[model samples]
Target: MNGNGTLIHLDNIYTAYEGAAFPVIRGITLSIRAGEYAIVGGPNGAGKTTLLESMNGMLRLTHGSATVCGLDVRRQGCEVRKRVGYVVQSFFFDPLTPFTTEQVVMMGRYGLLGCLRRPGEADYAAVDRAIRLLGLEDLRDRPIGTLSGGQQQKALIAQNLAKEPEILLLDEPFSNLDLCTRDFVSGVLKDLAKKGIAVVMVSHAFDGLPDGEIRIIVMRDGTLSLDETCRPDEVESRVRKASTVQ
Candidate 1:
């Protein structure tokens, strides 16, 4: 821990999708500090994704509160999102989509550019850095939809990185990657953590995790059942046991 204080704070939050009568997640309380690597795990429909959405201000908090990067999530959603990078679990791009890989990555900086502001040299530099970080230089000119699944995933990650966010939230990041690709991506995330970027991932697969202590959070139904720090090797077992209702 870096003793830099909390980066994400959720105090008894309850969130629900619009038009849904019942909230999907409730009574959720958590605190995450800077430079921490956290994994959210549980069975299907375990509210894992909902928790991530709440943190990013995608879902409205029906009760309680949430703060990310010291900005109030409810009141400062636009500001929070500007600083938080989120990669969705699954996405499909139409084959004819006109955006090139570089263009898509540049979209990440759009929030910061704001209305009437164009991307300048510094923005281009950031995009180039992110593309190189994900090893996507060769594919930068290719249409995003034309790339393979693994390549597209890398592009998506690069896009988020272009924003220079303090926190990176990934949902099932390895879903489209193979064993070798998973290893590569894991190492990439680990390196980002070393640079003090908080990497919070929601995933089901436990293999190919980065080395070091990991913060494991297991959610069941709509509430957190376990939150603990453990060695990477113990994560699978701990999550498996904690996911079951006690």
Candidate 2:
């Protein structure tokens, strides 16, 4: 964490995709502290996912600056990624893929283990902890491709947990999950936040929000339109109102 306890700091940042005519997100400034639960919401083309990519240094900054985990995003993107975990909005694994759940989870440690080093006992322990945390113990040996969408989502989340990131950026994590599973995953995220891991998610579903105060950041036209702290029940309405306004 930084000296001020801010894990993510973006100052007037602008990010653009390759060969794009202009930046996808522009003049955006935001900060997130450790243990805070923040939701990013907006209409379909509001650049919510682009914001996540900018936070984790996945996209190049075209202007201004970004710092995550106390490292400069543009200058230290590779290092920044090591301490921040990102779960993308969509992924499809081929059914014929041969990796097991455990193996998939273990892959998260590869960044720390590097190319030549083997996974040590500590690595295995971390993988085990992640699997248990995600309630995937019974399915640890099953092929990842064979699991249901919700199960696969859990495994992917577990994989990121194995990395033990200080910040977790999830883009619509509840998309594949059913009602019960959404609640279950929300509880897990709540626990993670309580343990001091920053959770910033892009989501449309607000029914299963974790208890207590929450932060809502709404975007429109490639920039933040609304940002405030509110109750869980007020999130959807606030976002809806912000999104519909001219």
Q: Write the per-residue lDDT of candidate 2 for residues 1-246, one digit (tens) a residue.
A: 788789999999998999999999999998999999999999998999999999888899999999899899999998888899889899999998899999999998998888999999999999999999999999999999999999999999999999999999999999999999999999999999999999999999998787888999999999999989999999999999988767
Q: Candidate 2: which stretches are off by over 4 Å?
A: none
What lDDT tens digits, residue by residue, belong to model 1 across residues 46-104? 89999999999998999999989989999999999989999999899888989999999
Show the colliding residue pairs in model 2: none
- Candidate 1, residue 83: lDDT: 91
Off by over 4 Å in 1: 1-3
RMSD (Å) of each candidate, 1 decimal = 1.6, 0.9
Give the distance in Å from residue 214's predicted Cα in candidate 2 to where it truly belongs. Answer: 0.5
